[model samples]
Target: MKTNPPAVQIVAISADEAGQRIDNFLRTQLKGVPKSMIYRILRKGEVRVNKKRIKPEYKLVAGDEIRIPPVRVAERDEQTVSPKLAKVASLADAILYEDDWILVMNKPSGTAVHGGSGLSFGVIEGLRALRPEARFLELVHRLDRDTSGVLLVAKKRSALRSLHEQLREKGMQKDYLALVRGSWPSHLKVVQAPLLKNILQSGERVVRVNSEGKPSETRFKVEERYAHATLVKASPVTGRTHQIRVHTLHAGHPIAFDDRYGEQEFDRQLATTGLNRLFLHAAALTFTHPNSGEVMRMEAPLDERLKQCLKVLRQQAQ
Candidate 1:
């Protein structure tokens, strides 16, 4: 017979916890609780801030008091990452830079930024498992599971808030390297399109260019030219979901090996060239340091597999 935990008392929001949404904060406080239950409580006014009903999206402010309702939660064993697990352990070597404020790593392709969506664990979880002593560790931004490179993690709540603000204010500069089908016209430097995200009945997410979508823009520059493909540098001005992938697709040249918005023939051709993964990499990131206020730039080199693919493409072109 499992017993529910004692009722939670009013929690005063600290400066470190400020700026986070009520729903997200609740998720952290009420660990293992289902998101549906959290929303239900909020909708029914069972959860309140300063005795006032608040929406899930309401951001917490310093000095605010929050009241969390008691809820039944199943007692489940915490998922632990075995040190012998090669993939999770390899993250130690993937780290490009780390300090008291933030940590930057060259994330491997096929690895999700954080665990969810049927995945047991991901970069954030693995990191937390690795550093049990660290009090705060959170993702400042996210990268697609298939996209690799330059992923940032904040070690402090203040750093996370600052970095998020930079992203919102367009102060962060993110650059990607993508190998696309066909020759990218030099004159076509930018693609300004609106993107709408749609969830299929099967629960897969897809983004498309539509009039009803949010405005998006991606700047492109031809980096190298191959026989039937082109390597382009992509800088997304807007952080829309699948902005780069859909923008390149809208430009009539989808990325190589992109399972979702790519051409089957292009993937088949690249398959022979040793390109088995999406040809999109977060090559570089530039932003101001949250603590020091100094400009920081980091670059990640393409993986060996991607480099070998490029070598094969070059040989064929020659």
Candidate 2:
């Protein structure tokens, strides 16, 4: 007698999904599968991205192949999960991009990458709970806890691999919009600085510029101006920790609502501006498809907070 091989789920990926994780991909695909079970399978080498067993947090690129094992039910003595996980799982309906290989969400501010330090649940954790059979789901890039827009998630490992290469080559382009201080001096400007890590006693040990730091750069241009400030469009040429935030301050003009590096007095004046969520947004992104080499672009609409701030600014001008 011959035995049959377990049914496999195979998928091909694309580049618009350049930055996503493996585990997050599966959760979206297999909305019925539980996160704990998926994590267990990944740890045991049951899932493969291009035939290599990748961790749950493995980043994805396009054109890679994925293999998923047959699902099986196993009784475990694990404890019950928290209700917050269940709540986050329901947010999957907000997906902006989805294919066999990936799904990207417009990640809102105030969310963490994963559950750690103090957060027991994040966008990824909740998504995993909702997607069960998806063999992989992963985050391609990261956003600050208080920054909103254009978050990427990979549906499979192969897709993760293809998308990542574009990021490495700097073929991916991302643009941001911010309400900043003062009239920008130039129509086009690039802020080049070196970043160093500071060991802080209480606040975040953030990356800052110093004499002995890594080289970083950001480009900026004016979009509009307020009575005491300027609304600028900014782009980062190199992906570094806090590259934009640090460079903006390094130029003596901080973002309007920056709570950390922002001028407190300026932030206070902008209070009526209704810019509650750090005045930074991932406005647009463009990159070559990892699979087809075709160019792809995705834009995030201005959220309510920013819109409200714009309304106030316009009203103030009138």
Candidate 3:
């Protein structure tokens, strides 16, 4: 049976909890509560800060008193990852770096960053299950499920804020490696295009290059050329949904094995070389440590499958 709080509860914000948005804070406080219900209460003035209604985006400050109305919460069994599961268990070895404030993982391909949209669990969930004692863990940013490589997770709200600030200000650097069809022209180093996200009737999301879309830019540098493909380093100057994939497609070259925005023929050709997944990888990341104020650069080595594919491509080139 479910139960509702008998009376309104008031919470006093602390210094460590400050800087989070009101809606986000509510999420942590009211576990098992639906987001729609939370917003509904906020809209109806059922929730208040210092006896005054506040918007969902309001940043919590230390010493603010929040009034939460009584609400019924649905109870469900918590999701847990089995420690014996090879894939989830192997994540412990994928850690590239970890500190008190953050964790950097060499995320494997085909693993979603978070669970949703039919997935029961993902990397974050698996991590939580593995480290049952950690109080807080959240993704600082996201990567496509099929894209493998450097991923960051924040252990504290303050660290998340600091890392997000770096991302917003373009102070952090993200470098990706992609194998694309055909020889990439050396002169075509930069792709600047606007990208518009669209949802089909089937609910599948796709990004296209459109004038009315958000501004996006990707800088590409040829790393090595194969007989039928080119390995390039891609640096996204602006982050947008599928920016790199869309930009490469706009430039007449698409990533190999990218079913969404890639060349099918190119993918078919590479399949013979054992390349069955998307050929894009988040090769490296450079960012300032949230707590130490030190610049950190981390790199992830290509998995064996990717390395084998590259070897085949090199042989074909020769």
Candidate 4:
């Protein structure tokens, strides 16, 4: 029913493949191989770039040769539409903006941007399935699985490069609405801290403020103050993994229902009020269009669930 592929194969990186992480490239190249196997091969130096061992995080460059050692791979099942992805297929209706070179959508919460880590499929996979005619589509940026908001996708390589430049230059602006656990100080507006990332023995990632860390900054402005929670608009000046969550924790006001960086007791109390998910949302994004060079601003309204939670909180305060 299954047969091993060639014992070994060499691949030359193409311009479109350049800048992609080696691990992802392996996943695509070695279809049907488990992710663990891919990582194991990398650890054992079984995979090489230009005849030298490279780590999983290595970014491929155009014309670089990759040496892949063949291992038995199970025959992949025929592609079928995942029932769970049926909803993902509907993301086309949520399009906020689209053009020849760019696409934007109001990504729903509880949906991963891409499929991995036990997920069968995600937004990107779903979109690809829905638009079979699209030749090139790639996420320009990422949002957490549980964060709802405006998401940008590039439809061309040149657009992706230009937008990445904007992000690196900090010219792209993102605003988020978050409900924090405590009353935020009116005078406390700016948070400048250094964040360090740590991977626990269990493979869980965590970010915290540490002296020996990368410089990070976030600007907070109170939008609404509740009895036990405060609604704030957060603008991160430096993009880092979990920068907003870590910075909020550093300010002694972790976001409400933020299981990772929040206080369990506080979260439990809020959980009793029908709030089941984190209350952080990507409210808006502003950037210069990569193709047109015109300034563009996109906004995603708070989802009904988040809006209902705020309504309940305000009613209680009244």
Candidate 5:
């Protein structure tokens, strides 16, 4: 089950107006929410600046985002707040697949799986509200914030339990599409390494290859090549956290557009090629139906922006 994330909707508080701090500006924008609630979200990391969370006194940039985590609202007041929530509610309702027991979505690049670090609401909560009849709706898995593609959600408690069991038992197949940093070796490389996570003092977490960590495996195959990089299909046989991201990096072909786990020279090369938003997508997923005994496969169509970027990069190569 997912809860409402911390978040705030943006309204113009003019640059010429009395200097109001970011939290104060939120106090102005969200009329009914309490100041104490605002402070709690900030401290817990549910609210973010841009997409990154910040300190309580962080100055207001003209276009900064102030996320308000979800509040326990009076159902009676929903009508009253609907007007204020119209924009986000509409955008958050996008669905990729829906059935009585399952839901899948083509999540956008900037949204999180659920809220924290000051997000008021995330896609999951918005979806849950839109389908309240569901006894339970749980994310079957996760994708990174800046990577877009298919995500699965289970709509019933039984379904969620069964699906999660399948994942734990390694009864699922996951395939990803990644535009990578450099021309890949023509031969396929199946990186079998263990991943160890490191959390920095600043509260960010990243993963690295370590002999003592959880065993991980990634099968990488070149799909196509550009002058400087290659588009590869990565299939993970094991799902330790950040398995694919770390494996690809260890293979010497880090994913293009990856903000973390990317090498510096390759990151710069990606910018020159006009690639953005970590060129990775949950392209296909296969698992057994939690309700039925049959197999199911799900795929997401390539979004056009990535396609256009590839076309331009191919042109540059020529």
Candidate 6:
């Protein structure tokens, strides 16, 4: 006979759970519930924090009260771990920094930040599996799965809030390295374009330049010029979805190997060169430490595969 867990439940946040997002908290607590259903309940105010309805991004603090309504949860199968998640866990060597309040990682290209849409699990889920004793952990910001570099995660709710404030105030700086097709112009250093995001009929997301779009900016500086492609550093002034990628396209120099918003022929040619992924890397990040109040700068080196692609290009240039 199978019995449901309970009709209603109340939980008090502890120190371990203090810095997590409410959505993440619910996911951990209601392990068998579909993520969509959890988000749906959150949208309907079926879940509350401190007796008030809160948005999904609301971070939990110590002693906070969470109210959970009834929902059918599938029985747990404690014995199984998804292979993809296990692989992500195994790659924990990429973690760059860790402390009581935050974690910094060099997330690899092709690994999603969190599981959804189609992925089974990503860095967050992998970290959860890697550190089962951790009470709270949540991404402070996101890097596109194909963009490898310094990724931040908060261990405490206060830290997450502080970091969020930094991002909102433009105090956080992120720099990226991209290999773009064609020779980059020495004088073309800035891309100030408003970008609008659209959803295609297939439910795929695409970004384009539009007068109605939000203000976006990216600063570009040449790193190295190759015969047919250029290595450059891209610093985004305003964070928007695919801002750098789309802005690069607008500059008439689409990033090498970008499947979306890229030159298809160039991508196919790069593919033959053994460059299989988008040539975008989150090379560095700068922000004030949430706990220490000290400005911190983190960097992630280019992976061997990306380095190899550059090596090939450099050889051809020579």
User: For every model shown, what is its TM-score relative to the native structure?
Assistant: 0.74, 0.71, 0.73, 0.73, 0.70, 0.73
Q: Estimate, for each residue in 1-318, the C-alpha lDDT of model 6 and write its tens digit.
A: 976577889999999989998988998898766554566688678999989998767899999999999887444532364566447544566777767788899998988999887877788987776655568899999988888889999988999999999999999999999999888999988999999999999878899999999999999999998878889999998999999999999989999878897898777756545788899999999999998899999999999999998888877778
Cα lDDT computed for each candidate against the true fold: 0.89, 0.75, 0.87, 0.85, 0.74, 0.86
For residue 297, model 5's alpha carbon misses the true position, in angstroms, by 1.2
lDDT of 4: 0.85
lDDT of each residue in 71-165, candidate 1, tens digit only: 76544422343433446557766878777899899999998987778988799997886566579999998899999999999999999999999
Question: Among these predicted structures, which one has the highest lDDT?
Answer: 1
Residue-level lDDT tens digits of model 4 in 249-312: 9999998878799888777767546888888899999999998899999999888889888888
Per-prediction backbone clash count: 0, 39, 0, 0, 28, 2
Screening candidate 1 with a backbone cut-off below 3 angstroms (N, C-alpha, C), the clashing residue pairs are none
Rate residue 263 of model 5 by lDDT: 74
What does the lDDT read for residue 130 in candidate 5? Answer: 56
Angstrom error of the Cα, residue 13, model 3: value is: 46
Candidate number with the higher TM-score (1 or 6): 1
Candidate 2 regions off by >4 Å? Answer: 1-90, 201-203
lDDT of 6 at 259: 82
User: Which 10 successive residues of model 6 have the least lDDT summed?
Assistant: 73-82
- Higher-ranked by lDDT: 2 or 4: 4
Clashing pairs in 3: none
